[model samples]
Target: MLSVRSAAVRAQCPSCGTWSSRVQSSYRRTASDLPLSGRAASLAERVRRFHCDGAQRTRRIFAERHGEEILAPFARRTGRLEIVVHHLGLALGGGPGAGFARRLQVPVSNDTLIRVVRRRATAKAYAPPRAVGIDDFAFRRNCRYGTIVVDLENRGS
Candidate 1:
């Protein structure tokens, strides 16, 4: 367990983009961090809620922005911890990755690991075949016919 706080005197409002030093209230947020010395580790941060002073009718009160590079809003785990989990899910898959994460003192479910993989997936663009080669073959005395398509550019089927 580790306790910390942001040293910045003021934080910029995410909605209005105005820097505010007026602190409305403060709260503590906990997030799971990487293991330390083979033991589970956690970080407790004292977050401050600021009153937006911008003229724009945006949010009245907003919490201090903990940059996404460190931890995302409402995230239960640190950014680095999530990265490790993402890699584990990609390498070992859901079931095995969850088991490995448990061995590393990271508490995560197999379903969560699977969700992480799905959430991070990106759609790949499909390209039309540039050069195609089509051929027909007879299985037995022209009784059965089969067609084979190959990409002539890459020389692959």
Candidate 2:
């Protein structure tokens, strides 16, 4: 049983970016949260599904946008928690990151940690550079070669 529960109301649909007062349905979402006082915490988020206004949107219904700082759709952990876990995964390897999460009372596996890191990394937006530097290097013993493209503005690949 969840100790804490609440309902969220949103006048806007994130998908279609339109307002809809007609609630299609609602559901409870269990989001793992940061541990409190050495005990694991979670939230029974009563998420509302709103009927999208007819604006040529593909999705007829869209779930209410929850606190973006808290979590996202289909996310198990809070956004802040995921950020910390991602940092841990970046600092440590997969196996070590898993072990660290266990100690932190965040039940995350090695595979989950890897996924977190990959997701956050890909979610970032990099500004397009005016010019890019391209270089070629042999990847294998005179067999395979790979091209390295570096952004001149950010010096990132």
Candidate 3:
């Protein structure tokens, strides 16, 4: 399963728009999902490093998918790490995102999680607009209000 996914993922390199056919190595990574009760849902994936023959050198390795899911590369804790960071942002008001990193067996920083979230938000905000709408929301929880612009063109919100 891993080999197949790796092969499929390595077939295309987004950086150079070239098809990769040579695989150098393979490995396994595990990731965690949202908690079920007090436990977390985990997934293990096989990853591969590919040799890119394209110009303008870029990343040589990427993850493949088993069935419908894309697996993470390098480590098994990617999912858990993301969850921790997201939860930290919501629970501790984003300031303790870094502190949560220290709690992980593997080291991470709050700044990294903040950066990831910011990047995702920026990407979504700047995505090409198809349809636009305007709405109003509370600015201060029943005290004030403001207008919000929404893009309804995209499928995912």
Relative to the true structure, how large is the alpha-carbon lDDT of every model? 0.86, 0.78, 0.57
Order of the predicted models by TM-score, top scorer first: 1, 2, 3
lDDT of 2 at 2: 44
How many residue pairs clash in all the candidates, one count each? 0, 0, 2
> Cα deviation in Å at residue 46, candidate 2?
0.9
TM-score head-to-head 1 vs 2, winner: 1
Tens-place lDDT digits, model 2, residues 1-157: 2433335344676666788888988788888887877777786777777888867877888877666677777888877778878888898969998898888888789998899889878888766788889999998889899999987778632
Sorted by lDDT (best first), the order is 1, 2, 3
TM-score per candidate, chains pooled: 0.75, 0.68, 0.44
- Model 1, residue 16: what's the lDDT? 81
lDDT (10s digit) by residue, model 1, range 13-114? 999899999999999999999999999999887899999999994898999977765778898888888888888999999999999999999988999998
lDDT at 58, model 1 = 80
| lDDT score at residue 54, model 2, on the 0-100 scale | 63
The RMSD (Cα, Å) of candidate 1 is 8.3
Ranking 1 against 3 by TM-score, winner: 1
By summed lDDT, the worst window of 10 consecutive residues in model 1 runs over 119-128
Question: Tens digit of lDDT per residue, candidate 3, span 1-157?
Answer: 1122333544666577777768778776656543444444555566666677787667766433343224334434454456556566655654566665455432446666666577546755566787999999997889889998877776552
